[model samples]
Target: MTGTEPLEGAAPAVGAPLLEATGITKRYGRYTALDAVDLRIEAGRTVSVVGESGSGKSTLARVIIGLERPDSGSVRFRGEPVRGRRARRAFRHSVGMVFQDPYESIDPRLTIGEVVAEPLRAHGLYRRDGAARVRELLDSVGMEGVDPDAYPHRFSGGQRQRVCIARAVATDPELVICDEPTSALDVSVQAQILNLLLDLQRRRGLSYLFITHDLEVVRRISDEVDVLLRGTVVERGTAEQVTSRPQHEYTRRLLGAVPAISPRQRRIGAPLISDAPAVPDSKESTESKESKESNSA
Candidate 1:
């Protein structure tokens, strides 16, 4: 790949794909994590990658963010090759990441302000009056007036996630990679976080590379969906189209597994009663009803 300079500005030209990866491949010893994966993200749009565990979703994210170099193929940002120090620095400035686990992604020792300001410090973008910027960032994510001296452990799971998001956007990056960002939170808190992301995108015109396993979450947030299986993209299309009318067998099976509500069930607000036989309940039994229910979803 040729070394080329990225655009100085964070935003891409209107209607252009901000990031593109073509024929990307990666392998670990005998196992391939990705196989000739091609993906694109348009400016100011959300493109989601969905797959089961070990399906190479995380590998793709790592490659895009420059954490892992692909064994083959190329990555481009704003129509330029992401090669050499300057180009990579430009890429880092243009892209931000919100990792899967808020608890582990952040350092417990650092105060909230220091954690959020780390990106600015790395890029030499920190200002002498940077405390104002920190406050503004926190307010943007709905955490106004939070004490800058407070450590991460003082915050709840959802609050820690908010701080993480605050840090990711500190540089006002054009693209954000969200890797299963809400998977660790409770269902109610997940909704709030999703809405916060949506608001941020709307206000900043940010493009998102959202990686998750939940199709329902994909349906809610993505403009397009790419379904990966065994390190290859099995199917891709508009979110509604892919989820509603999958063409590949793998895609079909994945969609089929989603718990759906039938028309009758919707009308009754519950599933139809079945006459199936119940399992014999005993304290000494190996199987428990709670265990079965826990594994249902």
Candidate 2:
């Protein structure tokens, strides 16, 4: 539980686990989106969760940010159980998010500055210095050209995403859960957004629970990764270890699906391929799949 134990369920970490979820179980009617999943995130590190479309990565993110509650299990923030309204509010303020579609995420009616400033206003973080702070934040994310009053529809997808990033960081959250944040952008734009996220993490010591099916992205942004298949974590390890030296069959299959690119980095500026195949049904215990469907219905 303390300072970067990195290993699992060993103790009450000294430095504290910024976010931890134990035996999290979620059922949508009959289908179980998550099954007894345990996760630990440390401050100032990026942890990628690699999975197919239906592997429950989105479900996990929703539960983490309190958008969805698990039927069973618990989520802890800084080692404190998060269940009450106050705790959920605290989670909202401390855990920011950037969704997949920038255009959909940003309001076309609002200016870039307005969009970024909304989080502060909603969280009551606005003060006498709010205006100045907004510009600084905008500039930091490279959307300085955007007039604080210029509407979101005037900007390109990449610029809009930058606005989203600025807004998510407005509360100065300790952790950012980016759910396919750049999936809608062009290749060059994706690189810019990805780099922006990395730079912010370095400058602010932010932790990230990045969800994506893109293995190359996992290597680029994560210090470590957890591969999920059929709603369960199948493999967990450092980026180099997980990406370069996969230990599980599922993990190997995921990596094998990655397109050939320069080993040094992803082939950015190329179109992104977020539409990867789901885990094989036969691989899942028939009981587990049937059990989840019962929950889903």
Model 2: how far residue 149 lies from native, Å: 0.6
Tens-digit per-residue lDDT, 1-297, candidate 1 = 212122111222246678999999998987888888888899989999988888899999999999999999899999999999899998999899999888899998899999999999999988796888888888788676678889976666667788899999999999999999988765545666787888899999999999998887787788888888878887888788777777777777777676443555457754222211111123223123223322332
Model 2, 1-297: lDDT tens digits are 111113221223235689999988898877878888888898888889889899899899999898898999999998899989998988889988999988688878787777888989988878889999899898778765457988876566666677788899999999999998876665435665787888889899999999999897888778878888878887787888888877777778888997654433354544232321111123233224333423332
Please give each candidate's TM-score.
0.83, 0.82
Error of 2 at 116 (Å): 0.9
Question: Backbone clashes per model, in order?
Answer: 0, 21
lDDT of the candidates, in the order given: 0.79, 0.77
Among all windows of 10 consecutive residues in model 1, the one with the lowest summed lDDT is: 1-10
RMSD of 1: 11.0
